[model samples]
Target: MPRQSAGILLYRKTNNELEVLLVHPGGPFFVKKDLGSWTIPKGEYDDSEEALAAAQREFEEEIGSPVTGTFLPLGTIRQKGGKVIQAWAVEGDLDADAIVSNTFELAWPPKSGKVETYPEVDKAVWFSVAEAKTRINEKQAELIDRLVALVV
Candidate 1:
């Protein structure tokens, strides 16, 4: 079975323009990546748990804030690696600069036998729909379009 993940695309209006929040993954591998690397705060889940519930849990874990509102399902997409991502769009706001992401441990330098701790998400930013389209993962860009269609 293909891996399944769930996430939330949090958005808010500013000056009558649509803006969505996107997060950058942490650690050395993603340290120098930018364009086509950002993504909605997400994590994997199993059939035992509900997708929406997992989405909310991942959102809070990655963004360090609980999200509450009507979750409009944005549907799902298959990533390049074949991991299916189930996502939703919710109208909300978050302070990108104040984000505090959870941490993970990974062996640095590949085979050095040294483990280092790093945040799951090192940065969060709000981008206009157009900007987000360029910054977000190619497969996940569909979520932004779905959000615009649902809310605009």
Candidate 2:
């Protein structure tokens, strides 16, 4: 079975323009990458766990804040690598600069005997739907499109 993940697409409207929050992955592999490297704050979950609850947990783990409100289901999308992502759209706002992401330890420098700690999400930004399309993974862009269709 393909891996399943869940996430929340946090969005806000400013002066009638809609914007979504996208997070940049941390660690050496993504340090220099930009376009197509951003994504909704998500993580893998087991079948025994509820997707929506897992999505909320992952959001708090990655964004350092708990999200509460009505969630508009954006449904699911299969990524190129066969990871299916279940997402929801929530109307919310947060300080992009104040995000405190959880950290992961990985062996850096290839064979270096040292493990380094890095934030799961290096940073987050609010982008207009058009801008998010360019920054987010191509497959995940569908979530943004779904949100646009619902809100606009």
lDDT of 2 by residue, 27-143 (tens): 999999999999999999998999999999999999999999999999999999999999999999999999999999998887998999999999999999999999999999999
lDDT of 1 by residue, 22-56 (tens): 99999999999999999999999999999999999
Extract clashing residue pairs from model 1. none
Which clashing pairs does model 2 show? none
Indicate the worst ten consecutive residues by lDDT in candidate 2: 106-115
Stretches of model 2 off by over 4 angstroms after superposition: none
Judge candidate 2 at residue 131 and give its lDDT: 98
Worst 10 residues of 1 by lDDT: 87-96
Best by lDDT: 2
Give all TM-scores, in the order shown: 0.98, 0.99
